[model samples]
Target: MVRAAGKHTSARLVLICVGLLGIALIADFLWASSSSSRFALIGANWAPPVSLLTPITIPNKGVDSQKNNTTTGRVLSATFADLPAPELKWEKMAAAPVPRLDGAAMQIKNLLYVFAGYGTIDYVHSHVDIYNFSDNTWGGRFDMPKEMAHSHLGMVTDGRYIYIVNGQYGPQCRGPTSHTFTLDTETKKWQNMPPLPVPRYAPATQLWRGRLHVMGGSKENRHTPAVDHWSLAVKDGKALEKEWRTEVPIPKGGPHRASIVYNDRLYVMGGQEGDFMAKPGSPIFKCSRRNEVVYGDVYMLDDEMKWKVLPPMPKPDSHIEFAWALVDNSVIIVGGTTEKHPITKKMVLVGEMFQFNFDTLNWSVIGKLPFRVKTTLVGFWKGWLYFTSGQRDKGPEDPAPKKVIGELWRTKLNLGS
Candidate 1:
């Protein structure tokens, strides 16, 4: 009788275990079939089936299809289209004449004007390198104005004209400058514009509705963040007003933020609140690294000229002011520095490419770069996404900056038809 009772108990335990396993499998099937399963579960640590990661287009009815209505009139949502990964084939292009960081570049006609920037620990470039998209070659470089800032410049282009605003006049944490200049790409000449009332370090600069808007940057001390906003009416590479007029200040102002004007809407995203501080009584403004708060906060200047908050980036990113390119209705941003690692407490260089969909107001990691980098100058030309000239990282797993690179790279953008 005792042996029979033990056998009965063993049989019941086996049945219960099988039942629990069956329930778990059913639950997993249900979860994977759901729409939210397009993205892999957090900490999954395992590869899901390819079909589970395929892109699925869904109709969006709740959002209106109106112009300037925050949706960008996007009728369909391609939320997980880049899931698993997009077809990113980055090809090497002509190398830049010099390596630089904190530089600026703009695409005008068939030429990409790469501006001066920090060359090395002891050097700063004061020249412009032009890349001809037509022939895939670097044209003859030209000298910038003697007064042009070498780094931290806020630049924007209006057709044949390129506008450059205030920045650090020189290297080693030097004082910010108040000078502003505009260049005529056709004539290859630089013209002086009305200087900024208060000099800033890498303020968000953009052109909107016949006015040049400049906002947010580091103060003269090179540590404190500034919230001052100013604008000036300009035309044909010349400022119509002698003085900049005050505008609504950015709610969260800082330097190295990406600024763009899409369909009359102005946006500022990704920057840091603090920067290197100069040591007291230093002649060359020698500085030391300071604690900073890098944020992904995004803001938009609405049609009413009031700032409105928008969906922020997935994580904190900085030094991305010039590392973004507009593709269709999406802004494809390349590499930059992100928050420090939790365990190592070391700054983590961003290797992933981020895409911000204007229509959905959502951010996504579309792909990864060949190597991690920061302050990369990004441009979109003839269906190709081009990025060049920034500080490259040590390796894939290491985020420490290794060296500055001038190798230009481009990949065919196959996001949409």
Candidate 2:
């Protein structure tokens, strides 16, 4: 009878232990879920800026390992206040008809127009897809006048007309073209515009004060960087004789620059100075080296028509082919790739974002991206920012197969919590 009583006690103890273990697992799951949600809330609110610091690991190199060293000599910091963070809503819309990378987008009224870009295969596409925001659906597809494939082509719009500027075409970094064309949104037709003075690609163009300003691209298939600046004005609404006038050139020009006009002044930032290919028979060429240069310099063209170099970015070798937009009078630079991975030595996509305050000339970490993206089309409409299709992953050199994304993502910009 004593043994039977002891067995009953042991069985009861076993049951209690099992119940305790189950409770512990449930508590752990709840904690993990809450922590993940908190992080998501933080990302949706504000991305804190993070500085990429290279610690001097070589022993006795006379460099302090504790100090964060970057090529720009600026330390990145985040100042988070106790104030409530902004609440953001993200929606996944209809995907594009075709997957593309290095595309441009322009929104006219309720319709969003996506232009030509490199497709999934070897060739570029001239397909034009339209998205109607009012109906929340993608409409019919249109074709460009010509079949041209150029990544990093400049595109801008002045409500009624969309301008397509110089870009590279054909296979393997072919020479840049001076082709410029404008599409009438009302008529659904394209009209040839005055050609650029110099052939280039990856130039940033903006419509400022009824004039189209084109500046800072690469010439000769990105072999040479050009600082040539030009502005085209339509005289008396006459499109036939539109004349492009020369403007003050940028102090330094490079490929894949992000340009925007804020407060009547032009701001250019983040581009590299080197070509993709090294000179023939060079030592670097013999080694098949790639991504030789990257830049993080920021410059502004003031109302006085003078270019002033601003403080360098905290992250050196940043903003190479990234997406940027002016939000709340601040420049928000999104995801782009760095030249080389710090650990793997492969090219890496920078998933973090930074914001530059025009008033104070300071930068802050805004937030992190859900995924890595580059050469994307960014559009701002109705208090929301849209990040469209782009290339994902680290490009061709990535150990895994790269993907050209077609997903359309939008996030509310100014929605208060």
Candidate 3:
């Protein structure tokens, strides 16, 4: 498990415990192996003296047709599923065209905006796509002028605009670029935003109280994932045209691009800084390195944006493609590749999902991914959590972007409680 004040792991149902400040709530999943549940949300929590909301799981068996939902300038597949028992309905908001590992997404209103990602494609893509759930249609696509790809790009949305933070151009998979961009939801346009003080890939970005904060990513010189934390005002998009000024640094280790906003703070999860070189389309394949993944740690920013490393990820796996979500009211980190196995040298798919709580800094267990999500973008919508599209490559024998999934799956949280 991630962390709990009491240090117990058998928490399936959540509870509230009275504490000094006020109260806190806790919960967990009594997950069973034979579970084939649909996207559902249930009212559950831990009453360990504090009170909080926790989402319980219910199995589902319904399915929907795989349809395409274009989100602006990006190519993605969207689908829908209704969990009957729980009466929860959801639509697949957005997806990346192919197996784009280490990709990211931003949500605004009914649409989900997807940004740069890398995979089988030879060149880095700076394209941005948005998906509208209301009309089940994709808006026009926009390009990220910078040659962007391969980054664990941290993403954030102000319910009106989407912003991109630190990412580097790599010669390994595709290449790297030192740039930042933001999408204006109203204008449906992308404007060059402020650039980071340093050029790094896979740093985390989040929004709180109208300000944008960026932390962690690998610089060209391979400095320990930039521990610096920077903040800027998102005043009428003018900030994009300038440079990113610096704030406080983490004062410890660095953070990866995999970040999530919970209870108003940015929880930056795993990622590492290394010398990576991809053949043509692969990113993070460093020279002299076995294409292995690193960074077994996790951390979060306080309301003040200060850094505090939390419990590391569940097991051990690394890939700029690694993704995280807040499913079932628990912070869930999922799929990415690792070069641990020689046969599948470049990358190997992961189905594991790790859940941790933002409050107690406690970690718990969760289910595996139901689909092959190689290039995944995580998000929450209408009471559900989503894993966007990704890809897989066959062993050298039939090596190609084997499975490019346009499928979208949701594990929603019941807001009825």
Candidate 4:
């Protein structure tokens, strides 16, 4: 994996120029779609503020020596180190082609699936990219079915199909689409699913047991994000063979990001209370001065759908979030900026990655991610966590400073008990 620190001096300039361009492009695409089945990208807030990118180089890693690193007979195990804590080096297995930033990624079997993300403010892409670990090739990109841009799209795999949920669409997220679609892994074909009840973006979804559980996100008409959760059971992927039912509300409040399933429970991290939180605006709606605060704090839900608080995160917190599965009952999360931005009055970038172990009920810092990107897809591939273009926007932080990293990064996760 790659690692690097940002030049604090150039950060402000990048925010304004890049952010404006992104906003303009999103507006242009919302009114149109590609002649092909392809779609356009929906940007997250302005742009991912000053991404903390450490592009992990894959070939440089001695993949040949990895066989000895496997302590538990699990192939490709990783040892995480806190930059300064230990000399724990992450061995890169493979890499992604056309390095895309602020895009979405999902791992099914050894295949990593990538989708929509903003290449720049005015340049949202609807390319469907994929990477196969078994073959180590990154081609096989199919076009998305609609013009859906704006980051923070909820993604989950129902063990059979991959689902892309709602986010901002049409002219910088001016008009919204309750549109839902699924990707047939076998045929690589796109099929539309039922639209969300309310058009919302940056919502959280969990694939548990046999259900696709969707949590709160910012609403279209109202500024308030919801705490109400919906559960869908897929029979053949047409309609929700089973309807949506309510699950537990976020203990702290409504509108949460990064709702992931681990050890029979759903865990959520930082997120703000506003539409397209990736842009500039006040993120506090259902929040208290404290809890409303973008929190690094972690919360949990049991199989019974009960809520409980775990350990709090190492602060300055974030408003957006992404999650992936890990060893044991653990899960890993990346990105989400501080509770507030340094200049534009919006949360810029935190460049933080963390992991939660269900058995231990503990949180640990993994490693710093590369700069200049948001998380669209953060999934497990082989034994490493593969991250793709991740972007989103909430309030009015426009030109919506936007940034897109045209690359992919991977790191090894130490999934030991």
Candidate 5:
């Protein structure tokens, strides 16, 4: 009888061991499948170090409390705002040659030049797609110089020339590169410029007072914010200085922020403090979301080279470093990533068209977009506000988007009521 009891116990132990082994095998298979699928999509040989389903580790603090307190209390919304219709509609135009995020766009007369961006999961694009506004068609495509970084680039144009600054090179959150280049729109030629002393990811770059000023972007680690402000003397698409000169650092340092020169004053607005970081010991630089603090804080570099706090945006916005247009006396911003939802804690994307009136020193929600999207390239031409190429959400409520689109949409700029 004792022997029989012992045999039953042995059988139970064997079954439990087999069950545990089965569970382990399933987990391993799922991880491998996830890694292989990403590799297959990007046609890369390296394996992913982190699973895409890994939960992001956010701090206990709420996102609404993330704004810079120094600048939050000074500004108020305009009492008599010029608001567009809630159901404002847009008309679709030509589709982009490549749908992308993290790309840059510049309108040179009748032509819109779109730069390199992330085309697919882990795939970085290195081509320029040109859209002609004269005939409303995609005119041509051209390859970027091989030295150019594929994504997270800082691009700005001076009428006939487009200048690209330091950005993330290659794919999968790779290290930032110091390479800089300029493209002549008239000749369609590329020229290498003096590299940045410190490469930064998505720095706010603009031409101000005959110098290319670059400020506030993530450091080489892909997460640390950089406050190192530098400028190089440039004239007529040529670098006049051999090295960048140090300038006054921004009060808030981060990337994916908008910087523009209005009335000869530099305004930097709407950026986040934290960004994705690569896992330690990752061979392929597998990326994961870090604890981020998005802000609507706006800072201005006055003529005296001093930083001044300005009115913040209507909400904490980011991913809009290049998604802005200077329309008349106001700066118009399209879609971008906003703070996470309060209840669900999921990331939220901005759908409304926002305008910051330089005349009134106020902000107003001017219009609503067709849908919520992020990383869109915007241009204003002939009274039309055009946006193209970005990731789109499933619906108004859904924060996660499964599709990237190249469809161009436009609305009349004068339709504000």
Candidate 6:
């Protein structure tokens, strides 16, 4: 009886072990099937089959659209889709004729025109340089009617002519001017147009519907701000001899903001309300107080002629003095400075790049540049972005020399579906 009982106990133990193994196998098979189906649904439309058990490591070639061949029997149908993202390729082009900062650049046909700003040795300049895309060369140097240099000057083009509006000229921000000029690309001549109603520096300006609209800037030195908006009335398809008519003012006008017209709507972004810089030994500078207010608010002018505030920009503190250009319904903003440092009181340069989609109302970071930059001349032409001379560092003081950049950079913009 004892032997029979012992044998019965052993049999029962073997049966329990087999039952656990069968249960585990069933659970694993069910999990694998579900995972494979989910991945197939997500990736079958675009990517090849893959296995979930095998890890995927994307190579550093360019984009992640290539397929992975590693597989496991349990997860044979798992795969990943190629996401829609911007593919960028940056290359160094020919250097500019002169090194400068805070200049304006515009593109017409196959030519890129760059206007005056602060040169490396001079406080201001009236020089103009042209880049020919056909030959990939820089030539056609001309001079403006007067010296123009400031942190923020408004410039636009209508394919035949380039218009420049109010800006400052001096070693310091002491000479705010209301002067406006237009350059005839065919004649290579600068002609005086109606000046702005108010003398301001860094006012946002754009050309829309046969009229030039100007708004917001520093009124009289970089201390006081202006919120006025004016549009030049067109006569006989020309803006000559036309007076500026007052329109709806911007809700929160500031200096050095970027203004652009896209799809018949005006959009403005990034500026400061107060003095951007203070004297090195001043109380505000020494104490490292946040005297200047950098804004990240984005405003748009609708068809009704009313200003509608859009979603605020991301990374508000570091959105000042960046260069902006529109490419295929997307707004691209590159490189700017952050607020003053608490201890050193110096502004920090941010090298981040971002793109805003108009249809989706979303902002995404594209990539960082090779170096930090601000007040750079940027324009998009024929699927390539041209960035010219700009300042890599703040202006020098006393014995130190100013560091101006002279290289031209070109990048191919690849939009993926």
Model 2 lDDT per residue over 1-417, tens place: 999999999999999999999999999999979967855543443233442222224324444422553423221121111112122356887888877777777777778888777785356677788987766678778888763435668877777888888787653445567878888888888777788887777787877766788887777646567888998885222244556889998888767778777888877777766555434655322223345456667888776889898865544333334377667768777666555544445545555556778877776655545556676666666776777777776322232227888888877664222
Q: Candidate 2, which segments miss by more than 4 Å at Cα? A: 1-90, 147-149, 235-243, 277-290, 314-322, 394-401, 414-417
> What shift in Å separates residue 135 of candidate 6 from its native position after superposition?
2.5
CA error at residue 201 for candidate 3, angstroms: 1.0
lDDT by residue for model 3 (1-417), tens: 367834553343233233422422222132431222311211121111111122222223422112232222111111111101212244544444544544567656666666656554433446666666565555567776554444556567666767766565543343345567766778877777667676665666777556777776655544445676777778665573255567677544343436667777766665555535443333454433423245546666666656776665543344433366555456656565432333333444455455666656655434435532354666566655666766644532222236755456666554221
Summed backbone clashes in each candidate are 0, 5, 61, 65, 0, 0
Residue 201 lDDT in candidate 2: 71
TM-score of 1: 0.79
Please, what is the TM-score per model? 0.79, 0.71, 0.63, 0.65, 0.79, 0.71
lDDT of 5 by residue, 105-193 (tens): 88888788998888875888899999988789996788899989987788888998888997998877789999999999888899999
Instruction: Give the candidate number with the greatest TM-score.
Output: 1
lDDT of each: 0.81, 0.65, 0.52, 0.55, 0.79, 0.66
RMSD of 2: 15.9
> Among all windows of ten consecutive residues in candidate 4, which has the lowest summed lDDT?
76-85
- Candidate 1 residue 416 Cα shift, in angstroms, is 3.0
Better of 1 and 3 by lDDT: 1
Worst window of 10 by summed lDDT in candidate 5? 73-82
Off by over 4 Å in 1: 1-87
For residue 79, model 6's alpha carbon misses the true position, in angstroms, by 39
lDDT per residue (tens digit) for residues 1-417 in model 1: 999999999999999999999999999989868745534442132222223243334426534223323421111122321123343678999899899988999887778899988898557899999988888899779999888888999999998899999898887788888999999988898889999998899899999999999999999888899999999999999999999999998998789989988877999989989988777888877867788888878899977989998877755788988999888898888888777654455566777677788887767767657777899998888888889999987764356677988999988877653
- lDDT, residue 369, model 3: 53
Question: What is the per-residue lDDT of model 6 for residues 1-417, given as tens digits with 9 covering 90 to 100?
Answer: 999999999999999999999999999999989977855553432221122223334444433323443431111111221112233567998888887777777878888888777674336667788988777899989777754444357777788878788686654344567788777889877777787877887788888878888888877646677898988854332575468889899998667777778888888877777764434555322212236777667888878988887765544422233377788878877766545533345554544566777776656656545555667677677888767777664421111113678788878776443
Give candidate 3's whole-model lDDT: 0.52
Give the residue spans of candidate 6 off by over 4 A: 1-89, 147-151, 235-237, 276-290, 317-322, 393-402
Give the lDDT of residue 214 in candidate 4: 77
